[model samples]
Target chain A: MSDVTAGALESYLTGRLAADVSVSDLHEHVEGWSRDTVSFTARWNEEGEQRERRLVVRAESDAQIEGDSAAEGNDVETEFRTMAAAEDTSVPVPETYWYEGDRSVLGGRFFVVGHLPGDAPVVWDREQRQDLYRAWDEREANEGDGKADGRAKGGSENDGGSLPSQFVDAAAGIHTLDAEDVSALADCPPDAVVERELDRWVGRYRASTVRPEPAVEECIRWFRSNPPEIPETTLVHGDFRIGNILVNEGELTGVLDWELARIGDPLYDLGYASTYYFAGKLIEPIERPELACSLLDREWFYDEYERRSGRVVDRERVRYWRAFSAFVMMTIGLAGVHRFRTGETDDVRAAWFQYIVPGLIEDMLAIVREDRL
Target chain B: MPYLEPAAVLRRFSRFALEEIRPAIDGEERFVRGQVGSMASTLRFLAGELDASERAVTTQENALHEALDGVEHTLDDHDAAATAVREALADARDTLDGTDDEAGSRIRGTRERETTLLEACDDVLARVEANLDDETARAVRRPLYDFLDARLDAQLRTLGRRNESGDGSP
Candidate 1:
């Protein structure tokens, strides 16, 4: 188990499926930071019939930072189970097939889910590609690319267009899920939602600082004095944004990361989604300067969200949470810079966070000022 | 108005953290077992410092509010005093233009009061400047710093103008 030996995965998958199986095209997927993700093709002969399938392996790592994964009461098992449970729901989660929580199998908790084929919606390196933009435009224009049957018939390139509508529909579906059904998730008491979020992030900010920031002190006081009231309790995808999701041909094949998924004030998710508008990748109309538009114009997505959910969003509350989210981003980004300065991770991505933190602060202040006016 | 001693408040908080919290939880489970074991202790130290800094900001905000309140209270007095000074200066100019007499004496009295009001405004401005530190004023720091700087500049210009007009005492 020092490495992902082929024998180990084959043995594990065979045990879970109760069939003799062989894994081929064994390769690792290089997208995650909290967990080691691997993908492979599986083949088996059953009753003299040939069968083949593509699968993804998700394994937890001990070295990950706390916020990169869920902080409390949730872990890899919970994520796997949540994805498995959502298979029948309108949410477009990958279909989870096997979960192995005992550490003996792969040195840590791990699971396997069906691997749907598609280009991820947010590609960090090749973000300048026009074809990708065109594909996104086409998908957003269509509700979401069609079902897998349509995908198979039309082929991978022509297959997905219904993704945007599907993603929005999936989010609405998740919001509508009964709290009783997801009782394993601890709910924030109605009154303490904002306080809990503030405390959680304040702890993160406090824990992650390597250098003294006088401005951050003022930000904390201002944030606490003006806590926004929660409009309603709903499930929050703590890291919901364009980059965290996967899409193919404008269809959302799967919701990718669940490490930070939780039950909390729904506006947190809305605010989190708004973070994408400033991600330096998702600037809309395809040609406008990313910085030209005010953050208010980005409210189109939220407006659509409100219209779809039939809930009159508290604009002030959303604005406050959005500012809170930006502050959280600054804290986390600064933390990444600290880690790099302290020799935690050698990856260059850690340093990139520093360049983004100040811009995020400026954006947060601008958002707060605009809302106040 | 000077803000209450924020630096002193911060010092007290830091002392309490070092004396009380540090020794008590030095070897707790989470503290010892986490990746950054002793780093947690360092965070506690930083938190102590942050508490002090926060107290300072609160103190500064309170002082600014108080100063603005004082300005409001003296608004009528300031206007009346300034008007009387201006009237005396005008009367002195008229006396100088015509014959020196009891009217000129009356002008001098008004001019003296005007100088006193101007002196009071200058003293208040000086205290405000002394109370403010551009770097450490965290709450409304930028605007307050600008306001104080601009006020000082404006006062200096007014003093220069009065001197040129021969209305300012030697």
Candidate 2:
């Protein structure tokens, strides 16, 4: 069944811990679509010591397993191994404990991680947007208040408790990681980055689309014919955004959702992050929509990322990936719609995705046309 | 006929769900509340769409035909790529013509017609880009781009401002 029960979890933990255990305060996070995330306190006794630890379980839901989200190379084990590898990096991922593969335990494979503090901000929420905007304002004030090094130099400590610098830091941390170190990630050759990504998303689009989207098809054609030059390949946290970053009192605590993480062009993440389709454009009241991820100034972000990663920011290549990012978003939307239409998922949000299709198509068309000149 | 219209009923129920049922549920029931809110908005949008769907369908059909006209004009008489495009278009038009007598198949027919026209447009653009010069290719793509814009405008108009929050993350 879709619902993971406390009893099932307790039984599994008891067996794994080799001691009697009780699971309580189980709370399911309501936001995400792909995984079923449950946070709870598990009490057990080991070596005559009663212990209590708060933990989070990330499991593949039926929708994730059977729906279009079953994209190749993305699975619970991959996510588990990816996080385990990143534990040695600067990225603030949740500390992973163990991976469970036996389906009889929780109906599917899941992994446990230490429950980290912080709420994942919903970027579309007006209050969250205001919070990020205030962070930007505070950082500006600090920068002007004789903290030039803070803004100019760029570091987590000097970022004035705002998320922009930390956001860049997290992205840089991921991009700079040795791809070979992450043994679970698929090998994406430097030469085939653009070709592979285009083929993957375009193939998914063709398979899952409910109708013929000429705009999307045009984008696919354009992208296929005009593949961007890959500068270098690195580990890309494919869904890098403010929404995926956990924030507590204006500080980024953990980067959540690594299912989309992979080995690809690092610039792809930058392009995905900078899409207005995913940022300030969602908030009707935000007057400044140029902030990358609705947090960092676009140019500032590029400059900061370049400075941190020691990689030159190729604005032209970024532009190509930005346009391709629209296609990625459109393909994902179509996938959700396809899953819904095919009766694979009953989630109303999946059906609701059709609402965003036109806007994405408009973005793709506008970008290619304006940028072509 | 009933005194209350179906759209009006849907809107009223949507309001009831958002304002009445949602508030009555405990605040801790965030998932349930979110679902209720989504259902309300979806029903409200559906109510509006019920009235506008026919018009939207007609507009889309017109746009498809216009795009197909531009596609046919751009194709060459003897080129293999152009032949492929013509074959796709002819097959779609034939299917549409065959289904013209069935009133129930109107929407499906329009959608199938749209699929064929759009695929042909893509094929033509690909062939033109490969065969023709940059300047000529741009000239050929201009009208098709216009049709795409019009079709998208009709879609946006139909969808309105609902879910303006943009795309969701996985």
Candidate 3:
């Protein structure tokens, strides 16, 4: 919003859409913490008729959480290519129209994509949405009470209910995308995937360290000593979580936030998906439990993943990567704290980063101990 | 000099002579050595204090659990007390928004104190789980330990931020 005027965005859209396209009602979505996300309605004169369209603009911000620079440079371009490649494939990504990596376009890189029809329930704010529990219960009942194959029939459960099945199905679709078809990222060698990713992140960590942590040093040593053996190479939706995915009426309409997409071990996605409980939520079907359940319950999603991908997932390897994912998340949280403390960034989200890092560390330690012992 | 205790006089003389007198007369190498020695000693003192406090807390927590073992139904009460303490800590944390420098410092102190308390709770719970024959005692301890573990984690995150801030430095 700093220098990204509506006129610039409209012009950019005009170039992508029809010549008579006119954009109206540009507003920001405040719920998203990652990108400078803005949802706007576009009205255009097309074929002797006025057509209305909804579009979302995802632009990079000066202030960002850690591990986002991976999305910078040609990374966004790679994402665009990946999305385009997955168009005919099973993955349900939004159809990207225009992407501008140049800084001059809107003071930072951004992409415009087709706005899919869906509504993401206010999952973050659990209080107002007491109806979610009822919705979840109804879906479970319908699935059990001779309704249909709820998993196959995507998003038919109406009444604006919870979309847990949609979420799982969309994830399975992504996991099953033909790895051989993604030729654009063929240069990414499978063997060096771990090393490349670790080096890139470690370099970022080193640069961002205002004060060194002995624990980080120890963690690095441990990571190097006990690198998990890669079983299979697949495209990792680097930030595969409930928040990044969008669902409508019990069906996944679009898989958003491909900024963190990369070619790596598929378990990274599985581990990340399972760790959503740490963000404070119950398992998929049971939207509201009387008490919090173990994140391990979400392993059914992994079983579903294995079923779809036809790969026997090594549970021990998945456990190892889960700990690694937690460590990566902790590093990002630490980076946010570093930036905020150094006055490099002035954002309130930075403070929450401090609140979450320690919990992540403890969780990571717990995972490590559980795996080893 | 007359008013000063012997220990205070020796400490004052050592600090003054090492920091001021030795630096004035000695070359850069000697000054560097003196500064390094001072820092090392300061670190050693802090490390010693932390170690002693940790040991004392562990001992007291162990004794408390040992005493509670004989008392029937006391473990449940103790477990509930620990939960209440954690809830109080959480409430305190929720209110802290780092409004001012003093508030921020207080929040940090509270976080560290809560960490210590939660760790103690975890140690006690772990011991109870090991010693108690009753399944209820073990069941009650599980949630308490889990909550305390999560709480300790949250506090450690806050501590990580504080450490990154270089708060006490001039």
Candidate 4:
């Protein structure tokens, strides 16, 4: 909603590109709520040569970070820094360009990145799931010869192995990165990761109030009482899931949405991604409820992640995080509902978030009950 | 009280917004168009839930009372249990009694009562985890879980239906 005009973008890019830039095809990506993303193609002359590039501008939203008052480490600067920190890692991140701190240029602090060509597939779409099934089937068929690239079998060069393998490899790449790399992320002692995360999220839930959520309260008490064992702490992509990453012909293009990235338990991402809620089980019962993110089998994902990352997969710890992650999702839904109720933001999507609250609570309860029983 | 009920009015407006207004918006203004679409969806959901909200709240109130009674009974049955557990039950009962306010309207009364009962549940749960054994804690949490289930059912019945597009799924 900020004043993002083509003229302003041209003026800004003219200064950055050191030439008269003509910006066109300004398209706003409205799918993500965390930031205002607009992608455009810029043409300019540099060093006596004509140049053109597809770039994206991600600006801070007017709404509070994640719509929660107590949320931290989700600012625009943090996101830019996190992406910059991951530049050398195996995780595919968009090449970060200049970060503008002045709001007069973009109406908010913003950063520009190279726009990679890919689509962030909707996980719940049946056609998309069918495509993923084919991709995985293709990989499984070529499992023996150590050359699993789909391109060898008459596919395009970018059509590497299935999205699931690339997904796990990218996650392993993130988890294997040293915590010191992303020094700007909230750092917690290895032993304190579970408690700190639990308190932080629970506090956010308690702070957000559209109505009383006794289920969350009960979960808070139970999780607090029974703490999970902390295996190893690494940079956890706090919101890791298929929908946040881009895929081109069954290969990962770029890992988008770094706002929620932080340093915490690596298993947290596995648990968060493995939640059936994201697999579309909570919305409507899908056929593959066991699939994580509607793309990969849960146990297979765990095995692959273990083999790739060389970290032991603890089912119990993953179980704890699964329940906790659902609780986290419920809390986020509550926060959105709270924002809408309080008229903090007029985004009707926030109002629609209420529909997911009950289902999320149910998911959390189901996970917790399974653990206890 | 008019010819068309409130829900009908809302649904008509929602349909107009979705089918007529949204398409009329410039496709280049994708964010605005998306907002219009979300507006239609929210209005549609609100229209559907308008009538069911009161019933859902009433069901929740009744379930809350039942859960409170069950917790009280469990506490009494476990008189030989830990002192802190007994005290937790007693404090919950006292809080419910002290916070009872029948001076408000039905909806307000339900909301306030629900809040008080939830707070009591939180207190009892916190204490129970610290004081009770595995079996005793499970027995105590069973009724609370039932209460949670009823609460979830009421909420879902009230605001659960999504459009065919599943716009906000996950």
Best-fitting candidate, measured by DockQ? 4
- For every candidate, give the share of true A-B contacts it also has: 0.00, 0.35, 0.08, 0.43
Reference-based TM-score of each model = 0.61, 0.86, 0.62, 0.87
Give stretches of model 4 more than 4 Å off: A64-73, A124-130, A133-159, B1-3, B65-117, B160-170
Residue A68 miss distance in model 2 (angstroms): 7.1
What does candidate 4's lDDT look like per residue over A1-373, in tens digits? 5567789999999898778999999888999877789999999987888899999999877764334442633888889988999887878999999898888897878899999989987766788877766666666666665666444446433234667878887888888765788887877878898788877888788778666666777777779867887857888888898888998766789998988888888999999998877776544445666778878878988998898788988988888888888888877877877877887877887777777777777777876775443
- The local distance difference test score of each candidate is 0.53, 0.75, 0.53, 0.77
lDDT of 3 by residue, A79-105 (tens): 677777667656577787777887677
lDDT per residue (tens digit) for residues B1-170 in model 2: 88888889989998999999999999888888888888887887778777666676566656666766665676552233545446655764564454344663555644564565566556655565566556556655676787777777667666664434323221
Model 1, B76-148: lDDT tens digits are 3333233332343344334333322456435554334333323333333333233433322232233333333
Cα deviation at B113, candidate 4, in Å, is 4.8
Lowest lDDT sum, 10 consecutive residues, model 3 chain A, at: A288-297
Candidate DockQ scores, in order: 0.02, 0.30, 0.05, 0.35
Error at B155, model 1, angstroms: 35
Off by over 4 Å in 3: A63-74, A121-124, A128-143, A146-162, A178-180, A183-187, A210-219, A276-296, A371-373, B1-170
Q: Which pairs of residues clash in candidate 1, taking residues 3 or more apart in a chain or in different chains? A: A143-A162, A144-A161, A144-A162, A144-A163, A145-A160, A145-A161, A145-A162, A145-A163, A160-A249
Q: What is the full ranking by TM-score, best candidate first?
A: 4, 2, 3, 1
